[model samples]
Target: MSIRLGNSCVNCQKYEDHFCQLHETTVGTKHTCDSFDMRAAIKDDNNCTTCSRYMSATCPNPKKAAPHMLCNHWAPQEVA
Candidate 1:
């Protein structure tokens, strides 16, 4: 799927695990696709709304501004 950052998150770059600098997820290879960095984490049944990592005001991902509304990129996925 083509994951385009909408106006909500257009102000930032695509989320990269390395951007956090304080935290990183283990990616298997360098040649992997863009979606490779998205890791599956346990999500609340209510989607990103009740998700701590998502609604967090302090998340390092540039797209933290993205809302909890239903979107193609809102699903929980492991970063490995």
Candidate 2:
């Protein structure tokens, strides 16, 4: 499988090829079938290097009750 970095993930310099604590290591796939936090999506442009939602452990949008998938905030990296 191929793992694509989303726009958000790519924007953050702190995020590397090694993240995703649920898998206990960087996942190497388009998207993992594991449960991940949704809050990690809200990153502070001036303060945070990346959003905590990358793996916070809870869905911020509980009203939607979205499925447990890779960070929805993740935007597939653009190919030049």
Candidate 3:
């Protein structure tokens, strides 16, 4: 399976063990099937400002961003 860094599956709700939960089968990370539903990343009250992928006010993976600008790969930055 070809897995990419910014694949849609990284944040998909149905993504489990590189498998598609809805399809009940394994799927390639690079694959975007018809059932593809973008998953929203968990956000804090501060929102994108605290996201790991938020760098210099730009998102490395724009496709992962929801209409509201929330990203699926938005992980909270670890406290230094």
The candidate that wins on lDDT is 3
Candidate 2: which stretches are off by over 4 Å? 1-17, 46-80
Maximum-TM-score candidate = 3
Model 1 lDDT tens row, 1-80:
77532322112233344342223433323323333333343234544554345655544453644554444335343322
**How far out, in Å, is residue 52 in model 2?**
22
Per-residue lDDT of 69 in model 1:
47
Better of 2 and 3 by TM-score: 3
Task: Quote the lDDT for 39 in model 2.
Answer: 42
| lDDT of each residue in 1-80, candidate 2, tens digit only | 76744544223333346465445555443444425433444332421113344334443543543333434453322231
Off by over 4 Å in 3: 1-7, 42-80
RMSD of each: 13.0, 14.5, 9.8
Q: What would the per-residue lDDT of candidate 3 be over residues 7-40, giving only the tens digit for each residue?
A: 4564567787778889887776566666666666
Ranking by lDDT: 3, 2, 1
Q: Residue 11 in candidate 1 has what lDDT?
A: 21
Cα error, residue 76 of model 2, in Å, equals: 13
